[model samples]
Target: MDEKKIAVIGAGIMGISALRRLSENKRFLLTCFERNYDLGGLWVYTDQTENDVYGRKINSAMYSNLQTNLPKQLMQLEGFPMDEKCPSFPTHTDVLAYIRKVADQCDIRKYIKFNTEVQLVTPVSENTQDTKWLVTYGDNRKKNDSQVEVFDAVIVCNGNCSIPNYPMIDNEKEFGGLVIHSIRYRRPELFAGLNVAVLGASHSGMDICHDVSKHAKKVYLCHRGSKLPTFLPANVTEKTSGFKRFTSSSIILDDNDIIQIDAVIYCTGFKYDFSFLPEGILEVGQNGVVCNLYKYILPRQYSTIFFMGLMRLYILFFPYGDHEASYIKAMLEGSVDIPAYKERIEVIDDDSKRPWLYNSHWEWDKELAGIAGNFEPFQSALKKIRDHVLEVKAKDFSKFRLDAFKITGSDSFEIL
Candidate 1:
């Protein structure tokens, strides 16, 4: 058996899982490229938001006080539990430490190239079964110092939250207030004593709004969603209408209410950035959804190319990556047959939503685990914990994280 050379991009959670799974068989020669000095990806929080000393855009979206929205039990990778002494909803530092521990236990650091960035990845031959990939990368600081390497396969585990998606407002240019994306947001002190308008009602949007409310004079939690959490801070007011436009010192809501605000924080999520890959290799939709993927992991035309952790999940990301890594391992090791290109295209075309896996992770995890051969079934307790967390959050938006939980059985959990 010939050793297959594989390039895994980004030593984040997804990349670590891929490296761990693929390195199991000695036949795979894995080389992982990470731009940072260490693993942990987005969990690696830095006070510097815009650019590092090397003039690179900071990749972490972690805020100073951010804790795991999902509990540690649900966030654990298979057979790798977080520290028992740590709280269920551990802080970002705790999560990063856990990620480091996983990598150390798996001995995945040997395959990783720290301080290296993958500049581009292109298929050597478009239509061949044995098509190779050209991975061009170099020192993250030295733009001109690039080198190319050929590999039998490529895995893209670079995260999605790095590049922020800022929605255009009608008169945003005329606004005098400061405007920034949630990706650049780091602390609540920045909004102290000022009336702020937080745009978006998604997880980050709601969380940021709540965070800012602590220091801000007033926070308008603006969103398009009809259902707003009733348990908002006294200073945070729910605004269900969309943003009509922005004035110099105020914002016009869809309801024609003009409210004075000192700043606008867009928690409008992020764009899926695969700018390094050539156009035809993968197709991202205009609305920011990945369209060229078959199962949110495999590209329709390139069986050797896998994109891990592309879907938005309500479940913990570790298990999601674990399931994906298992499937990719099976495909790379010749344990499972890769689907025909035509079949893959048909499956993608029939589904309107290609990679939005929110609320459907259980079935998806089971399907991937089953395909990966002998693996334990997706645990029922995880789903229970997730649902319990959601219920707790819905009932008490600001105080849910204060509660801790312990899994008691395969389908039960006890709150502490």
Candidate 2:
């Protein structure tokens, strides 16, 4: 096959990893677009800046105690084992360093265009030509700021975290203290000495509550439903009982009948902003994702453009985004056959008001594993992942692991 030109939007963890895999094939001429100057997207550290949408300054990247929710062993890429000196669950900075190193070591940096945002992507002719996409990007440095590029295939690596989705709370505007979404969350210092109410019970919500409780007079970790346990076991000790969870759809009013809250941080999670794509090409679901695709990859109607990190789930206790990227890359390179879209798009709970496709981290992992034809029993899955990590460590970090008092961070490798 002729060397194909592929454009990847967003130079984040998933994008960098996908680019690395794509670089291995001499037949792939890849160009990565990032709106930021640096390689890391949300992971990169940045100072507080005024957010036009929220009308407030926020720490776009850094939080005082940000750490990976997954263990380092599972989180690291297949080849690069985490440094023995690194903590069990690596810090955000450590993850950032790892991503930066991968980009440099794999020589993907040369193919990337920083400070470039993808404005629009259109299918020139639906599945008619092998090269299916005419992608347009806006160059931030240019005055008029527009450029066009064609790609045989386009990987939508721009992840779900960029767009914030706030639930419709009754009288939200009328009874407000300080309402901010997770995107605007930087640090918890502003909530100090005050009553802070946090919404949602996801990983981000947990992190926010953990931080706010340290300084706030009283912190209320509020959620519409029962709190889901962290996928990974908690390691915090009894000395630090700073975080607490509460289930409440509405907050209690004050004596004066004012919906009193010093501040409310909605860590309810995010959705994809696919408005840039043509309506017929991709249908946005009520949950704010392209609904027609199976496993959140190939669209029901279009196969050329694939979504890499649309689903959030744990398969072998690893992030599903990276796995999705790997599968997409393989499919694009003709290494694997594209799976059936609708059959794989699992619909759970048809009785509910809104029927949602099951795209949780665990479900995504199993689906990808099944698609890859590397199916294993749950126990064997753990062992296989462990063996892979051990193999990488033996070749790459044998001396460090043996000499240092380091333990493998996770035992959930078999699920991958």
Candidate 3:
């Protein structure tokens, strides 16, 4: 059998987990590309604040004090559970170590080309069966002189959070306070004895506001949400209205209220960063969602290319990656046949009008899970996910992530 040449991009959790499934048999000749010196993707913590240098952008969004918001049990790769020593919510360092541990266990280090940044991925022809892609990358030694390789398929796991989404704070350059996104946020000591406004109430917004409130004299959590959590610290006051504009030292609320603040920290979240992909093939923008995807895995225009771990899920991420990887593997093996390419295009076209990006993850993931569930390991993980997400959502995010669990068997665990 001619081994299928598969290229896995980015050595993050999704990239590595996908590698585990893709390299299941000798039938695959897999190659993994990572720009970093090592793996762990976003989990690898770097102190640098500037996300972009020259042309490339830093992919990792991990903060120094950040811990896994979800329990370790929920975050485990289906077959490979997190180490017993790891706590429920492991730290940034702990998550990186766990990824390395998975890599060592899977013996995938040999397949990866470290410090190699992928420059471009484009299709070769109009024929569907002739699924050849040109993957160009630059090695550390000679970065200017790049090289290209042909692969049967491409799995994009570079992550969506590499590009931080900071909407314009409409004003005539009046605001002069320090503006920092959550990605560059490390510690809160910089806001000591000062007034800080944390924008957006997303996960990062909530977490960053919590961190800043400890040091800032008064932390104003300015968000558009109707209600804010009451459990927030005394120093952190939630504002339901959004920003109208800002002055040199004061922030004007949408309701025409003004508050003096020393800094404006935007926990504004991120957008999908897929610059390596061909510009015309995919339409990913500042909207924070990837469009024209069939089942949210394969792009409708390019079925051979798959993007993993882009969906916003309430459940753990590792299992989602595992399921996606398994499905991609199955598709390559022809064991699972999705709808015809034409039919897929129609379905995506119709759904494109709706809020497909945010609302379609559950159904798409479920469908993929059902298809991949026919295989070993993934079957168990998928079975529990539907119930698990519902159960987890029923509880409070702060307290729920703290609950401990013990893995009793493969793809199975009991909440402790």
- Which residue ranges in model 2 land beyond 4 Å of their true spot? 49-62, 127-131, 227-259, 284-290, 314-319, 339-416
Query: Which tens-of-lDDT digit does each residue in 292-377 have in candidate 2?
Result: 56565776556677777654433332334556666776777676776444443443212123434422334446557676552321
- Lowest summed lDDT across 10 adjacent residues in model 3 is found at 374-383
Clashes of 3: 0
Query: Would you list the C-alpha lDDT of every candidate in the order shown?
Result: 0.85, 0.62, 0.76
RMSD per candidate (Å) reads 1.7, 8.2, 3.5
TM-score of each: 0.96, 0.75, 0.88
Local distance difference test, candidate 2: 0.62
Residue 318, candidate 1: how far off, in angstroms? 1.1
* Model 1 clashes, total count: 0
> What's model 3's overall lDDT?
0.76
lDDT of 3 by residue, 182-234 (tens): 87888888889999998898777877787777789999988886775346777
lDDT by residue for model 1 over 1-416, one digit each (tens)? 68999999998899989988888899999999999988889989999988898888897899998977888887888889889898878999998999899999999999999889888888899767558999999998776879999999999999998888888889999999889999889999999999999999878987888888889999999888786655888888888888999999999999998899999999988887888997876677756667678777787777888899876676778877887888888888888888888988887786545344555768777777777784665678878778878887888778778778888888888888
Count of residue pairs whose backbone atoms collide, per candidate: 0, 9, 0
Residue ranges of candidate 1 with Cα displaced over 4 Å: 353-359
